[model samples]
Every structure is written in C-alpha cells, then in structure tokens.
Target: MAFACQRDSYAREFSTVVASCSPAEVKTDVNGKKGILKGFHVVLKDTLLFPEGGGQPDDRGFLNDIPVLQVTRQGPDAVHFVQMPLNLDSEVHVTLDWGRRFDHMQQHSGQHLITAIADLMFGFKTTSWELGRQRSTIELDTPEVIPEQVEAIEQTVNEKIRQHIPVIVRVVSVDDPEVEKVRSRGLPDDHAGPVRIIDIEGIDANMCCGTHVSNLSHLQVIKILGTEKGKKNKTNLLFLAGNRVLKYVERSYTVEKALTSLLKNGPDEHVEAVEKMQKSVKLLQKTNLNLLRDLAVLTAQNFKSRADRGPLFSLHRKDGDNEFMNIVTSEIGTEETLIFLTVGDEKTSGLFLLAGPSELVEKLGPRVAELLEGKGAGKRGRFQGKANRMSRRPEVEVLLREALAGWQPTEE
Candidate 1:
C-alpha cells in the first residue's frame, strides 16, 4: 500500500496511530563531529513523512510536537527516529515540514522533466540523478553534453513547465501489464505492495518511489548550470530548479556587490582589475627579495667590522628568508666566530642557523633547537632548521656564550 505521503504530496498533517516504538541508537555528524545519538524508532500505522530512499533524503517533521531526526524505510514500514517514544496504538498528530518537502518536490520533479526531454530530444538516457542541498545533477549515458544540447533541453523543460502539464500518480499491481510500459530499474529486494508510476501527461511515465510535484507548473523554472565529466564515459549535468535558482541568484548578486565596493570597479571590470593587482603584487615581491639579499651582505660586513666582538655573534631579521641567512653566513666566514643567524619575528616563530667549528656546531645545534622548541640537523659545521620560539633567542645566546667561554680555536 502507498503511504499517505505518497498518496497526497500536498498534505502537511495526518493523524495516525503508533504501531510500535523501540529504543534505538543512531550515528550522526554535527558540524563535522561524529557522535552516537540516542533516540526511539517509532512506526505509525500510516504516516505523511517520506522515508529516505530513491535518492531523495528523508523528510523531517514532528510526531506530536517531538522533532523527528530521521526517517528510514524498513521493508514496507516507515521508521521515524525521535528523542521520545510514544505508546503503542496511541493516536499521534504528524506534521510535515512543508518548506522542505516542497523544495524537494520541485527538484525531483525537475529532474524527471529534464530526463524525459533529454532522452526524447537528444537520445541521452539518464543513468542516475542526485537532488542536492543547493543543486541537482543527472548523469547522462553519453560521454559529453554540448552547450547547444543543454540549452535545448533546458528550454524544452521550461516550456513544458509553463504549459502546466499534469503530473499524475498511478498505483498498479506488481504483475500488471501496465508496469511493462513504464521505465523502471526493477523493484527493490524488499519492496512490497503495488508499484507507483509517475506519469507526465503524454511526455513520459517513470516508476519512482520519491515524492514529486502534482503539476509541472509547480517546478516554476529549471536552469542548467553546466556539465562535468563523469566516470565510465558519462556526463553529469548540474541544474537548479524553482526557489533554488532564485536563492543562487541572490547570493551571487550579493557577492558581486561586495566585490564592487572593495575593488572600486563594476562587476564587468572586476576580473581585469584583479589581474592588474596580481601583476603589481608579483613585481613588488621580486623587488623586496632583491633588497633583502643586499641587506644580508651589508649585515655580514657590519658584523665582520666589530673588532672587540666575542667568539659568539647573533643577529635577527624579521624580513629575512633562508636565502638571506645563508648569504650572511657565506660572507661572514664561520671559521673564527660561531655565527648564529635567525630570520623572522623575535616574539614568535622563525628559522635559525648555527654555523662554526664542526664539533661545536654538532653538539650545540641540538641544544639551541631544543631551547627554541624546534628540530634541526647539521653536518660540515652548519646546522639549520625552523624554530617556534624566536623570543628565546637571548637564552640560546647565553648557552652559546658559556660553551664558547671555555673553548679555544684549534690550530688547523
């Protein structure tokens, strides 16, 4: 038997007796976190809530004011999951979320119209379809759908909608000869009762279990967004129907307005303006890199000119990169003085390099990295790595000074 929801898609309320209610646990994800949800699975003698099946998500509604989290089809029964349980055989008021159900109807019916038109006009068979939150897609048997074909299909579908073609629902026996005339992928393994066929006037008849609009005009309009490459020599066509298209347009216009204000250019000129800004940024980056290189060399020279300096010397530059640190080390000659160079913020994270005597560098490099909350490796009198605590640079200097105080340059 067809559920009450399948019989009347327009109905929002139904009074049904609870057949059974059992404790149940469901797994769900909220805001990206997965957890187990404790609930009760309640079955009604008849319900207006559609179960999750046939590519359409389950309907969300209320059973006597308690929120229905999910509904699933178990064989011929519609199982409603809720937080509280109801007494068996008790009469309960069921309320369907009209907004959600209506939106789903528009998209599902739009897919049917598009599928029928594509097959009739271009011989493109719909292999599969998905009604998503914001948009819907239909996978065609062909490898590709050209722009012209999409336009034609979209135009024909909208025309049919404007014509207000009747969408009739017919329930036929499983062994009925009329079932052979309708398009079907066969029945589900646990499917029982008669089969329901959705007939679109003289256009097409398809066997489906999902709820759909009663009239083609209810679809309002359908916009074919575009097509994408699909697996196994197929094409996935994206589309928006009814209020979805309107919402998409509203969001798009809001974004365009915000960009216009920030870019100081109209929507038509925004792309060109962004391209020019990108070029200017690249040029500035190149100029900044050249300046840093020169600054590194000057910094090395300044350090070398310090006659009264000790065996350990340290320097920090917030704008410096790996190349800058390396250039400074190369110019300073780490043979006599142990060079400690860092590039980045002093209070935050950055890179550090310790270069000097091979043995001292190998021993002290690890300690310096530990103090700065980092890891590094070294060989041939050079150790370099990233550090997360550049604020501890002074602590690292003290450790290096104490180690160098008892040290003397070995005669080579």
Candidate 2:
C-alpha cells in the first residue's frame, strides 16, 4: 500500500478516517532530553504523513489540532502517535508540517545527487547515509575522501542542481521487471505492496521510500562541509543543503564578528591573535609560580627567626598550592616544632600539611583531618592531604594544642 505521502510528496493537508487508536509508548525527544512518550497509536485509512524509513526521519504534523508526536510504519500501515486519542472511525483533518517536510525533501534529494555523482566520478559507492538534524552524512565505501575529490563531487552536485533537472517518482509492482533495474540496498522483510523508485532524469534511478523534491532546483545548493573518519574502512562525507547552507553561513559570520571584537583583529588574523594570547598567558603563569616559590622560602625564614617562637607554628595562604606548602615545611625544618600549613580558600577547600615528632604527628593527623573534613596519610614525621573545610582550622589548632601539652619528645 502506497501512502499519500509517497504518492504526492508536496501534499500538505488531507482528510482521512481514523481506522484505529490504541495506547502506545514511543521514545521521543522532549525539550532536548530523551524520554519515553506515552501516547496513542493512530491508524488512518489514508495518510499524508510519511513514516520513518530509508534513513529519513518520520513526519511531524497534526491530527484534528492534536500534535502527532511521531509516525512509524507497522507492516503496511503508517501508524501516527499522538498525545490525545481520537475516536476510532471518526473523520479527522491531517496537516503536514510543511517546513520540516520541505527540508527533508531537499536533503534527501541532495543526497541522491551527491551519491550518484560520487559513484559515477570516482567509483565511491555509498555504503550508508544519515539524515542528521543539522547536517547529513554519506558514508562512502573507501578509507578516505581527499580534498580534491570532495571538491569535484561537490561541484558536480551543485551543477546538477543548477541544471534544474526533473525528479520523477514511479511506483511499480513487487514482481515488476523494472524493480530489478534500479539500485537498492534491500527491502525490509515486512515490506508489502509496490516498490517506489526515485529517478533523477539521466543521472540515476534508485529505490527509496523517503520523500523528495520534484526538481533539482528545489535543493537551492549543496555544500560539502568536510569528511569524518568512519568505522570499517569508510569515509563519511558531511554536507549541508538548501536552507542549511544559509544557516551555516550566518552562524559562521556571527562567530567571526564576535572573535574580531574580542581579539582586536580581522577575521583573517583571528587565529594568529589567539595563538599569541595563549603563549603570553603561559609565560605569565610561569613567572607567577616562580615568585610564589621564593615567597614560600621567605615566609618559612620569618617564622623560624621569631625570638618568641613556640613548639607550634601555623600559616595559611589562599593563593598558595601544594608545592608552596611543601616548600615552607622544607625550609622551616619540622624536627622541633609541630608545623601546620594550608593553601587555598579559608572557608571552602584546600590542601594541608602537618609535620612534627613522628609519634605525635601520626596521632594528631587523623583528628586534624576530621575537623577539616578531609583525610590524610603519613609516615616518619610528615603527613599531608587535601581538606574540604579550611574554615574549621581553628578546631584543628585546638586539638594540636591539647596534644602538644601532654607530649614528650624522645631523645634521638
């Protein structure tokens, strides 16, 4: 059975009687997120909606003002999934989303043009193809499609589009001899009725189930964006056709304008400007790290030189890192005094280090880590780890103070 969509791709509206309506659960994208759609599967006596098949998506439209979420072919019938159920056998007005249908037509037809030209020009048979949301891809049975070949194929495709050649759709019986003459990957086991063939007048004739334009000029233009590496020793050629090409150009221009303003350079110089900026940022980061290392040594010396220095010492630097904390501990020599060092935000997260008598450091490290909401490991006389609650440092200090009061150093 040939649905009205395949018979006349340009038909936008039609009247049909609902043959059946049943509860169904279909997968659909809701606001960019994938989710299950609980709906009713509607079958019509005749439908203008095209079901998903032959690498093209299903049609989106309306049935008596209710949105049709998806259309799928079940055996020989086109099943329309809708959120609201319609009374069975009721007459309903079906409206096709013209914009979506036309876009699919342009892309689908454009694909046939590119596929035919590639095969004729370079013996690159299309192993498979995908009609994507933004751009479509044709996977060629080859390892790579070089720039020169891409250019030639793209040129030929657009040339045919400009020639305004006629695109004819013919429906024939399954057993017809003409069916064997057209190109086909194969038909589904569930396929029934006649086979539909799409002929690009003198260019190519292939069996396809997707909707397409009536003439090559309807494609507007086809742009081969580039190629991507494909699996199983193949090359995927990326392309945009019709309005997609226009949208791509508009987006590219907008990005170029924004980059020019930010980089203070023309579009041609934008790449060079960004490269220079990255190099300068790297140099500045190196210089800042060197200064921090020197400051760490100075801070340690200041703590050691204190005339009233006690058995305990503590310091925190929000701008410092693990390397800075280790350097300060190294410079101060933690053999006599218990040292506590932290670097990063005072209220949130940071790294901490503790160094002192081997016995005392091991005992207090766990408790200190608990107060600071963290964990640490130690050996000999040094313990270090990351902390999540630097704001609780005062509590850790109190614990250290109590432990120190009861501690006695063993003679070495």
Candidate 3:
C-alpha cells in the first residue's frame, strides 16, 4: 500500500480507502510483557501512519475514533492494527497522535543527521538505532567514540539544527544514478517500487522508510547523553531529542534537589559526602554485628538459668536470623537438651530450627515442617528448615508441647 509518509511525513490527518480488515496475531516486542495482543490488521489504500520499520517505531493514533494500537509493514501492505473491527468499505478518518508522532519525527530525523555527521566526520557508520520511550540510541560501527569527537559532533549537529535545514523526501527509481548519492549500505532484498530518499539540505541524503520532521529546527535540540560498549564491541551512543531532552533535564534537577535535602550537602559535594557516609556505615555495621554475637551468648546463659523452662526447652524469637540462632543453640545445647526454635512473626514468613536427640529430631522434623508450611531434614540429632507460613508459628509451638508431654529423658 502507498503511504503519505513516503512523500510528506508532516501530514497529521488523512482519510483513505480500506483495502482489507481482519484479525491478526501480533507479539513482535522482543522483551515485551506476557499477554495475547489482540488486534485487527486493516490494509489501507493509502496511510500517513508510519509502520515500524528501519529502526523507527510505529505511529499510534485512531481510526474513526477507535484506537489504532500498532502499525507494521508485512510485504507490500502497511497494516493498521486497531482494537475493534472496522467495516471493509467504510472511509475511516485516520488521526495521528500529534504529540507522539512529532516526538518520533524529532528523534528519527535527529538520528539521520547524527548518522550523517558521524560518518562524514569520523568515518563511523551507524550500525543500528533504537527509538526508546525515554531515550534513543545509535550503535556505531567502531569500538571507541572518543569524548572529544562526541563534543565535536554535538557542536556540528546543533549548528545544523539551528540552521533550520530543510528535509526533503523524494521517491526515485530503484536503478536511478542518484540512488548512488544515498549514504546507505544498499537497499533491502525484498525492497520494491520507487526508493524513498530523505535529503537534509546541504547536509546529506540517506535511504530510509521512517517518518522525519520537515525542518531540522523542529528537533529543538539533540543531546548526546553518553556511550556504552555494545554487542561485538560497537559503541552505543545514548541520546535524547526534542521533548525527551527537556524531560531528562527536568528529572535531573528534581532528583538533584531531593538528594541535596536528604544527604544534607550541596549537589557539588554529594559524591564526597556519600563516600564518607558509606565508610562510617561499614564501621558501625562491624560494631553492631559484634554486639549481636555478644548478646546471643548472654541470651543463651539467661535461658539455661531459667528453672521454669525445664529440660525440653523451646524458644520463639521474631525476626531472628537463622545463622545467628544456630550460634545461640551451639552455646545452649547439651546431649540431653532438646531446643526447638522458630523465628519471624505474623507479618512475614521465616525459618525454623530444631536441635535435640536424634530420635526426637527424626520424629518432629517433618511435623514442624508440616505445621509451618515448610520442609527439612534431621542430621546428628539436629533438625532445621525454613517455614513459609509465619502466623502458623503458634501452631508449631502447640504441636511441640503436646508431643513432649509426659516424656522422660533417658540416660545418655
């Protein structure tokens, strides 16, 4: 199907003939959320909605006021996917999401300018580009993009944007000699009909099938955020265009102000203050751990002196860490001593530990797990495991007390 974007991408609204409308199965998002994406693929006689292609996202809008969620090109057709079905012959009014469409225009057009500059200035061709919701990226052919070169490119591109360069889209023959002027690797194997060439006045021309702004000034600004090492040692240049740059600037200031208040330091000194605070926290954590170990030993001694607990002693401590509880049991146990300990409270589930006679360990291990919604094993007269149901701690305690009732300790 022929599209208006192939000629004039700035057309916000246009009505066209409906060639075909049918249900479709679409789940092309690479790392998308799980769910069946139900939509109707409507083939139009002509369209202004740019179908997702050539590293650009699809245009989102409405058809007869019904939401057109996705658009894609399959073979020769530009498929408009809507939530609800539309009549085959009805002339539907297509409305482009103006804000989203313009944003895409800024980024896609900005990318073309950047790609041209990078190739012309540094001989680094863009391998690919991603038009993200928050930020866009261009993957370059080279492993390294120096900071100085990035700055140079920024200076040059922003100058072009300020110049308000004219972007002209012209459809040409596939074998036309002017096609050689396009700074493209080549056309696609499945590509047919006239080739669309996007020419930035006095800057460069490239073959692409994505929507772009008519004037470079509409981009407002292009900010090269940073760069990272990408697949096969390529340099991925992170960037923001137009409203996204403004969005980033606003978020950065908000975060900076919040951090300044929280850390009790000016934005300039935040890094230094954070590093100093981290060092102090490490020292305090060491002291705190030593104190906890000492408290565990003292708690064990206090439990042993309690005449009310009898021989078969049991304890329940909320939010008790299992490893530290083991250390406590080591201090409290004797050959005849049987201690069943469960940790955590009703708000959350936690672990249980049982240390006792081998016979008792084997008998009660499975029972403790069953009561607390957990599982474990008994070894060397000790049984320990984690429980999933924290509120059932009391039930485990009741079951243990009933089992040990009328029991007499045998001679070791």
Candidate 4:
C-alpha cells in the first residue's frame, strides 16, 4: 500500500527534516495507557505502519529486548507500539531490522521493475498492487496478457536486475510544479507533506511511500509465478523476488531432480518421459475398454440363458467404475431381463437400473430410486441413481419388481 504525504505550507522544510530523519526515533507511549518510560524507540517507514487505509499488515520487530507490537500511522508520523510504557524524555538506540526491511524493499523494488517493464514492453499499465507475505501481485489495466508476453517481461525484469540499476528515494513537495508532470498511480491529493517518490534509474519513477532497496541489483532475480484474470479488463500478476526467488528455485529443483530419478532421465529428458508415460496411460485405457466390452457380451449371454418365463430378471453385482456400469446398462438391458447393477468405491456408491416395457420402467424408476435412498428420473426405460450409502442388492431388486407390478399405464 502507498500513501501520499499531505504537503503543508512548510512542506519544503518538512521534506528537509524528514529526509535528514531518514531513520529517526522519537519518544512514544506504549500499552496505549499512561506515559511511562519504555525500553527504546523505533523508526518506521511512513507507509509501513498504517493500521488503517489499505488492508496491509503492520510491520513488527523488536526494539532491543522490548517487542514492537505494531507499527501504525498517526497523522503524518508513524507510531510504533511496545508492550511497556515509555517516559517523557527517555533516550534509547533505535534500529530497524535490516533483514525484514530489505525483504520488503526487494519485493517493492521488484514490483516496480516488473510493472515498468510490462508497460514499456507490452503496454500493460499497472492499476494497483497488493503486497502479500509469500507473493506480491500487481493488477494490470488489461485483462489478457499472452503467455509469451509475460515470459518476455519476466526476462526483461531479470535483465534489469542484473544491470544493477540504482533505486533512489526522493522527497519532493507535492506543490513542486514538477510533481504534476510526473505520472503516478496513487497519490493522495490532500497530503500536507512532501511526497516520497521511488525512482528506478533509467526505468521508472512513481510516488510511493513504501520502503525500497538502494539498488535494483539487490533484487538478484524476479520470478513471475503466474497471472489471473480479474474483473473489467485486469490481470493480476503473482511474482517473487530476491531470496524468495532463490527459495522457489531451490524447491523446484529438488522436485525436478526427484522426478528425473523416478523417470530414469536427466532434467532435459523429463518432458519426453512424461509424454511417453501419458501415451502408455492412453494405451492402457484402450485395453481396459476392450476388456469391458467383452465382459458386457458374456454377461448379456448369461442373463439370456437364465431368462425366466414371467419377466426375465438378471442382477449383475459388481463394485466397479461408473463407465463400466454405464456400458452394462446400455448393452445388457433389454425387454426380457431388467438389469440392476450396483457400483461402489471407497467413499460412495451408485446404481443403474434398466428394463424393457418403457411404460413400466418409467413409472417404477422413481419409486426404485427412493427405495435405495437415492433420486432419479429418466425417459424411456432406463434410470440411474447415486446412493448416499451402500444399499442391499436384493432389497433394491424386490422393490423395483414390486413397483413395476404396481405401475399402471397412464394416458399422455
């Protein structure tokens, strides 16, 4: 999140003072009660400690042994909170956790680099940004960015990182006539203080209050993870930078090496190995289909041989896949024998009941479904239902026959 400092009549003087206080510490109250002496004071980036405004988390660190519970913006100055109270004139050394601060800087600086490169290379202007814990995202003005364009932009960002460009922070009065000429996305108009601007030398400049690295080279690398389409022509870019990028690379390499060993190939041959595996899977699927067709034929013949004089009924009991049940319902079901098949997996089960005499089956289908604690309807004589629990095959068959016997043809 970025904030525009309200420039007052003494804006120039404030800029000079704040610039000098690049890292300043002041006495503050702790525990939000009486003003007792606390351990030490802390310096915070003006934008870093905003408890309000944008929904960004506050910066937290320790001041000597005392913990800085929260960093928040109080008007123009950022207030740092501690567990213990502070005295009126207590003196303590203030230090900003350089590691945490540098991480934020690298992320912010990398965002500028990528956004700027995207604008220059692809004409995709960044509309807004969200800084998150693991990944930060920049929303672009356009909805669709081609994959190739993203790859190119990523390359450019890293190329710039390698160039080691200077990331300079400047504080200029909002009233400075030159300020209007500069293009910035989010600049607060009613600000009474000098605006802090981040300048990536030879690349981009924008009004931003977020802390940034002194140089782009410190970023090391910028990794574009992925992009998502947003409402009204916007693309959200997820990216990582600096140590985060290194961590991602290390983890990814580990996974790749494991996959290579499993596939018995080098990193370059992994793609080919996966493709071959996919082809093998397809062949196995074809063989399975053939076996299912053969089984359906044998089952149909067996049902025909056991045909009863009244109503030839055949119940094929099998706990198998849905596709096989569908094939059985389509192929074995006929006018002579009504087929009732039950399929079950580890978690749930399903039933497919098909019969001839379209009218009888249609009328009894819903009742049969109800008996099995399921619900289904169908045209012609075929019906299917998904059961919430495993149902006894005999009970279902009996209820189905009873329903069929009770069913009466109705005038359409």
Candidate 5:
C-alpha cells in the first residue's frame, strides 16, 4: 500500500512499502545540538514524512514503532533515516511526530500570511524564509521595516488567523489560468506538471510545497519579535507562532525574575540600578589604581645601595604588574643604574624588567630572561616581559646582580 501523503498532508498515519532499504551511515551534528551521529537510509514508495524542504525541517516519526530519525528528499524519492534498517519490500506503518509536525505547520503557515501582508501593504516582497528550532524569519526585499509597519503586520495577520479561515490547498496543471490569479513570484525553473497553491481565505494564495494545518486558526497567534538588517538591502523579520511564542514568553519572564532578585530592584528600576552600580565600580577602580601607583614609587625609593655592584637596583614584591614596574623604574633617578624588578605571588608566574646603560642593558637583558627560563627583547635601555617561573624570582635578581658586578660600561 503506497499512500501519497503529500496529496493529503493532514493524514498522520499511513501505510507504505519499503521500496528499498540500504544500510547507509549519515554523519550529522544535528545543528550543533550534538556531535556527529550515525543512522541508516531507507527509501519508501510513498511516505507521510515530509522530507525536509521549503525552509521546513524533516519530519520525525516512527516506521513500525522504530524511531525514524529524519526524512529527506532526493529527486523523486522520500528517504527516511533511522538507527536500524528496515527489511526491503516490507509493508511498514508510518506515523508522523504529531507535535513537531504541528509546530512546523503553524510557523510555516504564519510565514505565508506575514509575507503576503508585507508584499501587499508595503510592496516589500519576501525573498526567503527560515523555520528555525526556536523562531522563524522572513527576509524582505526592503532594507528596513519601520516600527509602525511591523505593528500593522502583526495586527493584520492575527486578525486573519482569528477569523478561523479555512486553509485551501489545491493542485493545478502547470498551465492553469488560476496560477496567474495566485500571488506567486513564479514557479521554480525545474517545476513540472502540477502546481500546488495554498489559499488563505481572502488574504493570500501563494505557491508552497510545505505541509500546513487545515485552517489558519491552528496558528493560534503570531508574534513578531523584531527586525534585523540582512544581506545588502534586505531585512529579516523574526517571529514566533503558537507554542514557540509561549516558550519565548516563559523564558523571558524567568530571566526578568532573576534580574529583579539579583539587583534588589523592581522590573521598572533594573536599568537604573545596573547603571548606578557600574558607575560606582568604575570610580573604585580609578581610586585603587592611584593608591597602588604611590605605593610602588615609595617601595622603590626605600631600597638600599649595593657595594661594588655598579649601581645595581632590584625590587621584588607581591601583586605587581607592568604599570607598577614602570612606576618604580621612573622613581629611581638617573645614574647608569642597572634596575631589575620581579613581582609575583605564591601560586602564579610573574614579570621581570631589566634597565641600565645601553651597552649593559643590551648584553644582560636577554641573559636575565634566559636565566629565568623565559623570553624577552630590548636593545637601547630597557627590556621587559613576563616570566613563567615565579620561584625563579630570586634567581633573576642574583643573575643580574652578579652579571653587573663584573661589568664595565663603555664611554657615552
């Protein structure tokens, strides 16, 4: 028994013959929801599973109670993917996943209604549409959609949906005169034989090959989320229909409640409270930096002299950064001084700086970095970079001190 599901989309259950069943593996990420999964490919003589097309996803259901992972179309074949292959020439019972199918139908039908309104009222034709897992979008030819126009579209679409209009689906010959009366951009270049048109009460009758419910009222409601700038001069209108709208509302309410509790403010005051906290955080950061700068200079000035070490200067401290090192170097007055500063805490790496006369700095800077098992670069006066070995801080100080202890600077 090979039932033509496309001829009667509302048929949830049907009988079909497994024309050919082949064990083939399909590797897919399932749209980032998971890693690659493997499945088998089985083609049916006739199937109710709409093999993913017209911007709608593949129908998921069962063939003889075994899960049908997905359905796809190849040329004139409806191919079903499953975990286990069915027997060739078997009479299988096909059942569509009612909820998933209904959701796709509602959103796909809503798109047609919305597209018709956009084209009829604003002369902005729909170039494309996508039925995403959580939301749907229609790309319009216009560069932008004004706020008023969007509100108008929502109002009109919902009104028609509330009218409980019977959705009329009819197939006609390719050269039928009725196709000319239908508001279609045109049939596809490769379209052959008959044309399928979905007529919405008095609003629209457009060419579509996707499954839809029997009536517009099944859409329940249509909510336009917003508009986004799309390719070149196009605008993508995001929307939700039926249960998707309900899910979006539920998620938004949950987030809003969390923010209200965390901010200790009502919904109306969330923006003001967050802005005030941000300003206070910025002010505190500024104040703390100024204090650290002063302490770095004081710490540098307190270091004592070194005998026969040729003006060697070294300082090691906790919580020190590049800015702290720069401040200390600036405080130590000129004197052909060879300065080294290594700073870190107990559990992490630190940074090192070597500064002195051009000849000594060039000779000793890279050597100090190497002694600490790190890399650095400098030529004229100062060399600075991070060192991954914090325990090697003392080794860095000793290497520079001993190197300078034997150094003699060239004439300026």
Candidate 6:
C-alpha cells in the first residue's frame, strides 16, 4: 500500500533499485519470510520497515531490468515489489526514477527554507509539514502571520534562492559530538544508527532522512503561495519551488495578460480598472431597482381593470418581473379579496397566491396545487408554487374557483 525511499548507505548508488523476493512463486508466507533459493532477485523498498507511515512518498525505481513498481512494509520487512517477470537468482541492475527523487528533494528542501525563514525573520518555528500536489505546506509554531510579514518572508526566501547557498548533507552518529551543532529541533527517537543532517550553510542545520540537492541553489526558487490559520497557535504556509515555481510564474503572467485586456488597461492600471468596474456595477444595481419600482406601479394600474370586486380573484401576466407581482398582490389583497398571479416561463408556470381574512388558502391552494401536480403551502395570506408542465392560466383559474366555492371570511 506504500512505497519507501530508504535514505540508506546503499542510496549512494542512486541508479540501483533493491528489492526482496523468494525463489519460489509462493502467494502467502506465514512466517512472513520467503524461502531463500539460489538465483532469486531482491528489490528494496525505499521506506523504513519499523517507522511505518509518514508524509513521505515511497521511492520508485527499476531493479535488474524489473520495474520496482512500489515499496511497502510487511511486518518487519520492507518489501520492494517488481512489475516484470524475472529469472530466479539473476543479477539485476537497479535504477531509481531520478526525476521523482529530485522532485521530492526540492519540496523537502523548500520546506526547510520556509521553516528556517519563519524562525529567522518572524521568530516562528515550523511544527509540521504537508507535502501536496502543485503546492506544499509548513505548519508554523504560531497562529497567524500578517500580510506584510508574509510578504517579507516571501521576499527573504527568494533572496536566499538568489544567494545560492551551499547545502551540506552529513551522516553523523547520534552520539557524535557534531550532533550538538545541528540546529534542527527534533530527531526521530526510533533512529538507532547514524542520523543524517542537512545543513543550509548559515541559514539552517536540520535532521532529515530525505534526499536533497548538494546546494540550495539547485532549488532554483522558493515561492509562498498563501497561508491559512490552523489549530490553536498554528498557521499553515503553502509554497512551491523549482519547476513548480516556474510553472506558477508562467500561469500568473497569463492571468495578468487576460485581466489587462478585459479591463482595457495596461498592467499597472489593471487593478484600478477592476475597482472602478466594481463600483460601476453597484451603481447600476441601484438604478435597476428604481426602474423596477416604477414599472411595478404601472403594472398594478393595468391589473386594476380586471378586478371583479369578488372575495377571491386571480390574474395572470406574461413576461413580468418580480416587482409587478409584488405591486399587484400588495394592492389587491384585503379582508374580502384573495389574489393569485401566475408567471410562466417557456415550459412551466410560477404561481404566487395571497389569501384575505378567510382561510381561502386551505380551500383553493391545495386544489390548484394538485391540478398542476405541484406543491405549495401558506399561512393566512400567502402561498406560492411552480407548476412543472401547466401552461394555461385559465385552467388554474377554473380549479381555484371550484376549490374555493364554500370559502368564508374569518378573523385572525
């Protein structure tokens, strides 16, 4: 289920893939040990067996012409599974996919840069990290970073990249005197042998098992994508580096170009243009509302010609806005007159209803709803519905009258 990229002494030969296998084609091994026979090939998983799960991705490489598809830990054993069939006991040439390996290196190194910069510039330490696709994150020792401070940190990291500092990798015994010189806070307790330390010259010296470039300059660039508040006293800083940084820069340029054209402004004026358009849109919205109100008054005057002076009445209007419905309903609804309006789209109808002092809603609303195969409910004076396929307003009017035949006024 996982691949382990072991940062072992054997890792010096970066091109070889190591794996473990048995001579016999056995499906299950109870002892968790495959029977050893002559000429069996072995592939090594990149992960440590005992440490188990971590955020690190597994190593993928080729073992003696067989592709080491994945690396996993089975009990105490780190198993490297191969993809191709191979002869038992044949000598194999192992090679890791260096592109993937280097990618992890860049990300891990970028994390060091960000975390170190946070501590140096802002007095914040990184508590954890999440390596992700397109971007990675470092959880800071503190809860929040202000915009100006974040910008400063970004500036600092980029400055370091430009410095192209030497990155030194040292394998030292846990009890070695040099271990005390390392500034990285935590070392895995389970590590029994020599520990690996990555030193970023004057910037950082941290304990790490992940592979890294010989120099910080290989990282090319470090970019801060964004940051968000995490759990108590923690903040997550998202970032990218190397090829990812290049891609991000390219994408940002493309977006800037599109925005410039849309706003009809040069790059320097685009931001101002966007703000101006936003203000214009708000003004247009207010003007539209005033126009709707005036139109509603005219619509109500036109509907007055159809009033029957009956206790319950209905009206229909084609292609009217919501304001027209509001004006008519508010004007005609009273103690004796119930009102209904149907607004139809191309394929369906919208019904707006208001009952008077009587419980005309209970009588007429359900009948109209059932006839149209719709659903609606209301209190003493209001109801609404969407009739899915009902097109004719006269049909709804007939159903409403029949349902309200015995309706009578009642006090609230």
lDDT of each: 0.93, 0.93, 0.84, 0.65, 0.83, 0.67
Query: Once model 6 is optimally superposed onto the true structure by TM-score, how far is the C-alpha of residue 358 displaced, in angstroms?
Result: 6.6
lDDT of 1 by residue, 359-389 (tens): 8998899999999999899999999999999
How far in Å is the alpha carbon of 305 misplaced in model 3?
Answer: 3.2
| Per-model TM values vs. the true structure | 0.85, 0.82, 0.87, 0.65, 0.76, 0.64
How far is 236's C-alpha from truth in model 1 (Å)?
1.8
Off by over 4 Å in 4: 1-104, 118-124, 127-164, 188-194, 224-239, 307-323, 334-336, 354-364, 367-375, 391-395, 401-412
Model 4, range 40-146, lDDT digits (tens) per residue?
A: 33333332223322323454544444566656564565666665544433443344444555666678778888888998888988888887888899999997988
Report residue 2 deviation for candidate 2 (angstroms). 2.0
Model 6: how far residue 155 lies from native, Å = 4.3
Name the runs in model 1 displaced over 4 angstroms. 308-412
Q: Cα-based RMSD of the predictions, in order?
A: 3.3, 3.9, 3.2, 9.9, 5.0, 9.0
Name the 10 consecutive residues with the lowest summed lDDT in model 5. 301-310
Residue 242, candidate 2: alpha-carbon lDDT = 98
TM-score of 1: 0.85
Which digits, one per residue and each the tens of the lDDT, describe model 2 over residues 1-412? 8899999999999999999999999886879999887989999999999999999999999998999888999999999999898998899999999999999999999999999999999999998999999999999999989999999999999899989999999989999999889888988999998999999999999999999999999999999999999999999999999999999999999999999999888999998999999999999999999999999999989989999999988988999998998888889887888999998899989999999888899888888888899989888888889899999999888888888898888777
Which candidate do you rate higher for TM-score, 1 or 5?
1
Worst 10 residues of 2 by lDDT: 403-412
Clashes of 4: 12
List ranges where model 6 is wrong by over 4 Å: 1-104, 143-152, 168-196, 209-211, 225-236, 307-327, 334-377, 384-412
TM-score of 5: 0.76
Model 3: lDDT to the true structure: 0.84
Task: Report the lDDT of model 6 for residue 34.
Answer: 60
